[model samples]
Target: MLTMIVADDEPFIRKSLIHVFNWQEEFGIEIIGEASDGQEAYELCMERQPDILFTDIMMPMMGGLEVAEKLKAGNCRARIIIISGAQDFSYAQSALKMNAEGYILKPVKLPELREVFHEAVTRLRQEKDHQLNFEQLRKQVQSNMPLLREKFLQNWLAGLYRDEGELWDKIGYFQLPFKRGDVLTAGVLQLDDYQSAIDKFSEEYRQLLYFSIQNMITECLEKPPGGISFVASENEFIVIFCPDQAAAPGTGAISSLCEEIIGSIKKYLRLDASIGIGRACSSASELEDSYKEALAALVHTFYTGHGSILYIKDIQPGTAALQSTFFYKFQARLMNELKAGHTQQVLELLEKLFDRLAAPKLQIDYVQSICAEIIFTSARALYELDEDIEQVLEDRLTIMDTLYRQKNISGLKTCMLSLFYNLSTHVAGKNTSKNSKTINRIRAIVQEGYARELSIARIAEEVFLTPNYISLIFKKETGETLTDYITKIRIGKAKELLHTTDLKIMEISERVGYENPHYFSTVFKKNVGVHPLKYRSGK
Candidate 1:
C-alpha cells in the first residue's frame, strides 16, 4: 500500500482532506500522518518516508513551498501535491519548478484527486515490474555460461577450430587457463556397460544418474589444478588436463590421477570405468591429436577388459584384419539358419564365429563390428516374418548394449546365443494354431493393461499383428467383438469395486479405465439397471 501525509494549518482543511474520499479502500493509499504546519510535514516525511505528501501553499510557521524544497534537498522520493487559495500563475510556475505533483485551489474534486493518485500507482507498478524482469534476465545469463562454455570445449575437442586466431579468441572468451605454449594432454573415460546398467530405469532417472556421475568427476579433478571435464557422448566423458609448466607431468602422476577418478566412480556410484590417457602435446592446437590418441586407447578396452587404465604409449600395434571371405561365409550361413528357425544350427554357427574371433592378433574393433552385424541380422529375420523384433525379443533395446559390454569373445557368444534362441522359438511358434494364439495374446494384454488405454491399434502393436486381423480373430475365437469384451471386463471390475469398496465414484471410474466420471455413470447405469450411486447404496 502507498502511504501519504496531509499537511495544512487549517484544522477544517486537514480533516476534509483526510475524509474526502475512500482513499485507502479505492486507491490503496493510507494517510500515515496529519501535520498542522510545514515543519511538522517535513518531520513527518523524514520519519515515515511516506510515498506521497499533501500540503497547503500558504500556512503558519512555514509554507508548503519551503517543505517541498527542503524535502527535495534531502533527496526525498515522495510525490508532493501543493494546495493553494490563489489562481496566480507564479504559484503554479513555482510548483512545477519544485516538481510538485499538483496545485489545487481551496476546494478539491474527487475525479482530479483520483486521476493523480492512479497515475502514481501505475508508475510505481511499472517500475517494480521493470526491476523484476531485469533481475530474472541477469540470473538466466549467469546460469547459462557454464553450458555455453561446455559447448565451446566440446567443439574444440572435435577439431572444429581451424584458425589459431579463432581458437585463441574462444579460449580467452571462455576464460580457459591455458596459454599459447602450454602443454596439454587428454583422457577419455567411459562407464563400462552404461546402457545395460541403466536399462531398467526411466529416461529421467538415467539423466539424473549421468548428472551425478559428472558431478563426481568434477569433484575428483579439483586437486589436479587445470583439469576440465565434460560429457563427450552418452557413455563417455572427456577431460583435458593443462599442467602449468613447460613440460607435462611424469606418467606416474597422470596414471595416479586417472586411477583416482576411476576408483571414486567404482566406490561411490558402484559402477566401473576405464580411462585412456593420450601423450601430452606442446600446445592447445595439438590437443585434438591427443584427443584422438585417447579415443584409440579407450577402444582397446575390447581387448584389455573393463576398469583397466590404458595409455597410448602402452598400446602394441597390430597388423591383422578380418578375412572378408571368412566373414561373409559365416554371415550367409548364419542368416539362413536364423530364418529357418533352426536353433541347434544357429548355436553351432555362433560357436564357430566366436572361435574365429578368439584368434590372436585379430583386430578387436573388427570383432565387435562383426557381432553388431549379426545382431542386426537377427532383427532382419524377424522383420521378414512380419513380426517386430522388439516384440519377439523382449530384450531388443538391451541387445546392442549387451553386445558392447562384452569384453571377450566368450561373453559375446553368450549374448548372441540367447538372442538367437529367443528368435528361433518365435519363428517356430508361427506353425501352431495361429489365430487361437492371437486371441490368447489379446486377452492377456487386456487383462494386464485394463487400467491403460486399450484401443485396438495399441493392442495390435503389442501383439505384432494388424488391428483388423486381431479384431477378426478375437471375434471368431470368443464369439464377441473385442470392444464389447473390453467393456464387459471394465464394467465387471467396476461392479465388484462398487460392492466391495467405499471408493468414490470418480476414483472407481479411473480405476476401471474411464476418464470421465459422467460417462462412467451413464455406462454403469446401462449395464446394471441403476446409477452408480444407487447401485452403491444397495437401493
Candidate 2:
C-alpha cells in the first residue's frame, strides 16, 4: 500500500525513477502518478498523500528541492525521498534541511530502495506511537476527572499556569462545563479522631470509612439538593447548582441538614462527624470564594471549638471570638519536640490537641482529621529520619481517610484508645521518660489475650484492677471503651481464621469468643458487609 509519485523536469528521468522499483517485488511501490516538474509534483503530492515521494534535484521549471520544501512548509504529510545524480552534492544539504527521510543517487539500486522502504515504515510507526500516547493521556485525565480537575485548578490559582488564556485552555481540555456566572455550592467533611483510628486499625477498616462518608452525605444529597450537580473530591463534595435555579439548599435548612447528617452518620456509622456548609455563589469563577469561606468555617471549629455543625451564617466572618492558636501551633511544636527527643513536651502537646478535639461539640469526622494530622505529621517526621514507619503511617492515613464510616463515637474512641496506648507504650516508648507500673501491667495483660475470650470484668480481675477503673484508664490512655476494643480484637482474630484456615463459620465463631454462631454472624455483618459464611467462601 506504499503508494508514491515520481517527479523530475525531464520526463525520462521521472519515468526512469518510477521504473527503478519493481512496483511489487522490491519495494511494493505503486507509482500513482508521475510529475514532470515541481508544480505538478506538489499538486500530485497534495492530492494523493502518497506514503513516499521520489524527486530529482536538477529540474528546469521547478526543482525537486523546492517541491519538497513547499510540501513541508505547507505541512503536507508525506515522507520524501530525493533522487539526485551522483555529482549533485549541493542538493543533499537542502533535502536534509527540508526533512526528506532519504536521498538516493540516480541509477538507483534495488538494495537501496528496499532500505528506504523499511525506513519509511519505521518513521510511520513512530508517528503512530506518538498519536497513541496522546490518546491514552487524554483518556486517563478523563477517568480521574474530579481529582485531576481539582489539582489543576489549584495549580492554576497558585500561578502554575502562565496566564488566563492558558488556564482557559486547560479548562476546555478537561471539559469542566463551567462558564462565568454559573453558581456552585459545596460541602465540607472532617474525620473526628482520624489519626488514632488509623493507628488502631488496618486498611480493611479504612475502606469502611469511605463507605461511611458516602452513606451520611447521600441522605438528602441523593436528590441533588436542587440546583447543582454533585462533585466529590477526597473528603469534600461540591454540588454545582444554578444561579437562577428554582431552589437552593436554604441557608438555615442546610445547617439543620448538617446537624441531621451528624446524628444519622453517628447512629448508623458510629463515626463522630462534623460538617460545615458554605454560602452559595453566583458563578463557577467565584467558587473559590465559597470554597474559602467553607474552609474558614471548617477550621473555625478548632477555635470556636468542635463536635457540632458550624455554618458560615451562625459564625461571623471576621474576629468576633478570639481564635485559639493552639491546634495551629501544636503541629510544629509537637514535631519539634519529637525531634529533640523531648518526650514529656511531645506528650503534653499531643494531649492538648486531643483535649481540644474532645470539646463537647467536636465532630468525630473533623476530630479524626486533627488526630490524623497529628499522627501523620509525627510519622512523616519519623519518615524523614529514615525510620521504618511506613506501615504505621500508611495505616493512620487510611484511618484518617475513613473516619466517616464509624457508626458511633463510642466505637471510634475505643479503637483510638487501643492504638494510641500501644503507640505511646511500644512504638514511641523510647521517647517517654516516665511510666507507671499499673499502665505497664495493663498493657501486658491486653497484649497477652487481646484476641481471646477477653472482657472488662475478666481482664480487670486478671490485672488486679476494678472493672470501672480499668475502663476509665483504658479510655483515657487509648480512647476506646473496653468492650468495643475486646470485640474488635476478637473479630479481627475471626477474620484471620476465615481467610487463612478451613474453619467453618460456627467453628470460627467459637474460636473467637462468640458462643452462638447467629450472634457472631450478626456482629460480623454489622462490622463487615457480608455474612461470616460468605466471607469464608471468599464471596
Candidate 3:
C-alpha cells in the first residue's frame, strides 16, 4: 500500500479531493496529509515522503510549480500531480519540466485520476523490485569472495607467480594478514584412505563433504594468528601460519593445532586425518619451499602410519634393509609354497615377507615392486592349477589400481592379506575334493532355504568360496547353472504344493519364494506349460 497527500487552498476542494475515491480500497493509497498552500505541501511532502502527491497549481506563499521544482531538487520521492483551473498551456509545460506524474484540469475526473495513480504505483513497484534484485546480487558476490580468495591462494602456493610485485598486489587485494618478512610455516593435512573414505558419495556430495571438512579445519586453526587455510587437492588441505609475534610458531604449536583439527574431524565426521608440518621460512617467496617440505614429510606416512603428526625437522630417514637379492629369495620360496598348495605355509611366508618389508622404512617404490612380485607369483600358482584370478580375487580387474590406492602400510597389508587368503582358498579347495562337498552343501542350503533371498554370492560365503568358483563347480557337477538349479528347486516345490493342497496362487507363490504373484504365474507357465491355478485345476 502507498501513502498520499492532497494540497488545495480551499477547504471544500481539499475535502472533495480526499473523498473523490475510496483511495485505499481502489488504489491502495491512503491520504496521509492535507496542505492548503504550496509551502505546506512542499513541507508535508518532504517530511512524509509520500508515494503520491496532488496539489492545486495556484496557491499562496508559493505556487504548486515552485513547490514541485523545490521537491525535485531536494530529492523528494513523492509522485507529483498538478490540478489547476487555468487553461494556460504553459502550466502543463512547466509541470512536465518538473517531472510531475500527470497534469489535470481543475475539476478532476475519476478515470484520469485513477489512471495517473495506477501508473505511479506501478512505477514505484518496479523500482522497488530492482532494488531487491540488486541487494540479492550484492549478497551473492560477498559470499563468493572467499572462494575467489581460496583459488588465488592455491595458485600462489603452486609457484605460479614469479613477480614479487604481482604477488604483493594479490596479497593486498585478498586482504591477507601477511607482511614483507613474516615468518611462515606451512602444513598439509590429508584424509586417511581418501579414496575409500569418500567412494560411497556421488561427485556432488563429495564436494559437500570437502566443504564440511574445510570448515572444521578452519575452526580448529582460528587460534593461530594470520593462518590461512585452503584446499590443496582432492583429499588434502594446506594451512600457512604466520605468528603475530617476532618468533615463529614452534613445532609444538603446530602439532597442537594439527591435533585439534584431527580430533574435530574424528569427533564430528567420524574420519581420520594426518598432518605433515614443514620448517619455518623467512618470506612469502620461500612459501613454496616450505610447502614442498610439508608434502615430503607427509609421504613418510607409509612408515609412520595414519593419524600421525609428522614434522620435517623430526623426520630421519632409515637404512634400506631389503635388497634385490632378498626379494628374489623370498619370491622363490613363496612360489614353492603356493604351488605345493601349502596354504598355511603360504600365509606364514606372506607374514614373513611383510615383516621384512616393515623394518627400515623402505621407500614406497621398492615396497610396491616387491608387493607386485608377490601378487604375480601367487597368481601364477593359481594359473598353473587352471584357476582364474577373477575367481580368486574380488577386484581382479583392478588389482593394481587397488594396490596403488592404498595410502599407508596398514591398508596395503589388508589388501594383500585379502588377496592371499582368497588365493589360498582356491588352492586348498583345488587339492582336496571340496568341489563335491561344495556342491552338496549348496544343494542342502538351497533345498532348505529356497523360499528365501538366496544368491550365489551368499551361498559362496557359507561354503568358503567365491561366487564364480562355486558357480563353476556347481555347473560342472550338476550340468546346470546355479541360477537354474535354484529356479528348478522353486518350481518343483510349487508343483508339489499345487498337487497336494487347495491353496491360493499368491500363497503358493510366496511359499515358493516368488514375491510377485504375476511374475510367479509367468514363470510357472513358462516352466510347466501352465499357470499355477491351471496346474492346480489340472488344465
Query: Which candidate model has the greater TM-score, 2 or 3?
Result: 3
How well does candidate 1 score on lDDT at residue 281? 85
Tens-place lDDT digits, model 3, residues 12-121: 99999999889889877889999999999999999999987899999999999999999999999888888989999999999999889889996788888788878877
lDDT of 2 by residue, 372-488 (tens): 556666676666643655544447546665554444444445555544444444334533322245456666766677646666788778767567655655654567777777677
Alpha-carbon runs more than 4 Å astray in model 3: 1-144, 201-208, 244-251, 316-321, 385-390, 393-397, 433-539
TM per candidate: 0.42, 0.40, 0.51
- Candidate 1 off by > 4 Å: 7-15, 35-49, 55-111, 125-188, 196-215, 221-257, 275-305, 308-539
lDDT for 95 in candidate 3 is 93
Instruction: Score each candidate by Cα lDDT.
Output: 0.79, 0.64, 0.82
Ranking by lDDT: 3, 1, 2
**Distance from true location, Cα of 511 in model 1, Å:** 99
Give the C-alpha miss distance for residue 16 in model 1, angstroms.
Answer: 3.9
The alpha-carbon root-mean-square deviation between model 3 and the true structure, to one decimal in Å, is 26.4
